[model samples]
Target: MLIDIFHDTVCPWCRIGKKHLFDALAKWQEQEVHIRWHPFLLDDTVPAEGYEFRNFMQNRKGIKAEELQHLFDYTQREGEAAGVKLDFEKIRLAVNTKLAHQLIALAPTNIKNDVVEAIYRAYFEEGLNIGDINVIVAIGTAYQMNATELKLQLNDRDVVDAVVAESAFARLNGINSVPFFIMNNQVKVNGSHSVEVFLEALNSTALLDIPAKI
Candidate 1:
């Protein structure tokens, strides 16, 4: 089974939703699944330096800081229930995700998930400025990639265009939210779903067989 996940790193729901999906995968360890991480930038118009989370949410959602914080707190609780550690207070940056998406595109198919998780943790948990070249370079280095070469590739016009094109395609397909999961090229599941939902989907596709674990 192939699962194409369209998500943004800084998106709280995306982060939480991914954990749920992973938990489902882990629960069904006998299943052989190939997961692909795709680009889906929530704030594609935001500058490279990004914006402060509080300010961006207030302006975009027309809500106050308290309300946003409450939402974050609720999300954090859900993440924790799924054994995901969400560092809400640590996540301070919200930059343009064009470059991050491009990097994901350039990565080898085998290591794409590793690279995606690293970027997500860096921005949401470690509070790193993921839009900065230096930070991206370090992230690439941590993944044993050629940082200098990646820095050079970051300027490629094709890379930027590809990310934008993917986002537009997703929108055209009725994807108005992040963490959208497309399974087996036919199942279009939007938003973050629970582990049970994913497991049921897997079973329906005959991609998973559940047996007693003792």
Candidate 2:
């Protein structure tokens, strides 16, 4: 089955969704799955470099006083339950996710998934500034990607244009949020969901009857 996922690197909820989906994938090793990560910027209007995530959340979500405490508490507990370590305090910013998304788009097929997971871990768990070029290069280097070449490609006009086009396509397709999963090009599963939901989708007639290995 093919799963087209639209998500942003800085989205905590997206991380939760990925954790749940991965859990389901691990359980269904016999089932062949092809995953594609698509670009979806939460704040594309932001500058090339992003803004501080804490302030962005505070202003955007308007969580103050007791509400803020409750929100964090709930998120932390939920993250723990999902097996994702979310270090919100260490998170400094939520810069433009376009660059990160672009990386995912251009990554070679063999390592694209690993690259996506690495960036997610860097932002959500390690609390690193994912907006910076150096940080991105560091992550890419771990996968033996050419950091110098990546720096050049990061701002390549063609790459930027392609990413922008993808973003516009996503918007036109009615994607209003991150972590949106379009299963088998038919069912749209929005937001984070339990492993059961993924399992059910995979077991449906749409995805069943995998061709036997030769």
Candidate 3:
């Protein structure tokens, strides 16, 4: 079965959701699973250089410093429960994910999933600016991808267009959230759902035998 996952690299929730879904899959030994990761930009308007993290979050969420801390604390605790680490303080900027998405889109099939996971870690854990070409090239290099080639491809107008277009298509289809999942192109699951929810979806007949019409 094919599991289409729409996500953004900077989204900590997507990391948690991925962990939970994979945990569920570990327990489910029934069918072969193929995961296809797609891009969903959290804020495409973020400039190429990006914004200061704290200030941007404060303005974006309309909260004061203490309130921002509260939000971060809550998210951190949730991440802990899901076995994912979120180092918000280490993040200096809230960057546009366009360049990162391009890298993922052009990655070799065998290493594409790994590239996505590493990009998430780079942003949420290491707090690197994924929007920067140098940062992306470093990550790609770890996966044995040719750095010079990867850099060129990431800047390729065609590749950038495809990556951004995928995000646009998701919005047009009414999917405005990240970490959204489509099981066998039949069952649609949204948000950072629980392992149980994922398991149930995996077992459902709609995804197994009777696929619902798209």
The sequence of per-residue lDDT tens digits that candidate 1 reaches over residues 1-214 is 7778999877877877888888888887655678877788787788877788779878888999899889888988887787767787886767888877778888887888888888878877788888887887787778788987898888889888988998888899888888888777666667778989877776665543333122
Q: Estimate each model's TM-score.
A: 0.91, 0.90, 0.95
Return the top candidate by lDDT.
3
Residue 149, model 1: Cα distance from true site in angstroms: 1.0
User: Which has the better lDDT: candidate 2, or candidate 3?
Assistant: 3
Clashing residue pairs found in predicted model 3: none
**Candidate 3 weakest ten by summed lDDT:** 205-214
| Cα lDDT tens digits for candidate 2, 1-214 | 7778888898878888988888988986755678888888778777756686666777888877567667877887888998988787777777877778767876888999899989989987788877777888888878888888998998798988888788789999899888898766776778889888877766662555544222
Q: Write the per-residue lDDT of candidate 3 for residues 63-174, one digit (tens) a residue.
A: 9999999999998888899888898888999999999988888788899989988998999899999989999999999999898888788878999889889999999998
RMSD each, Å: 4.5, 2.9, 2.0
TM-score of 1: 0.91
The segments of candidate 3 whose C-alpha lies over 4 angstroms from its true place after superposition are: 205-207, 210-214
Ranking by lDDT: 3, 2, 1
Q: Which pairs clash in the backbone of model 1?
A: 50-95
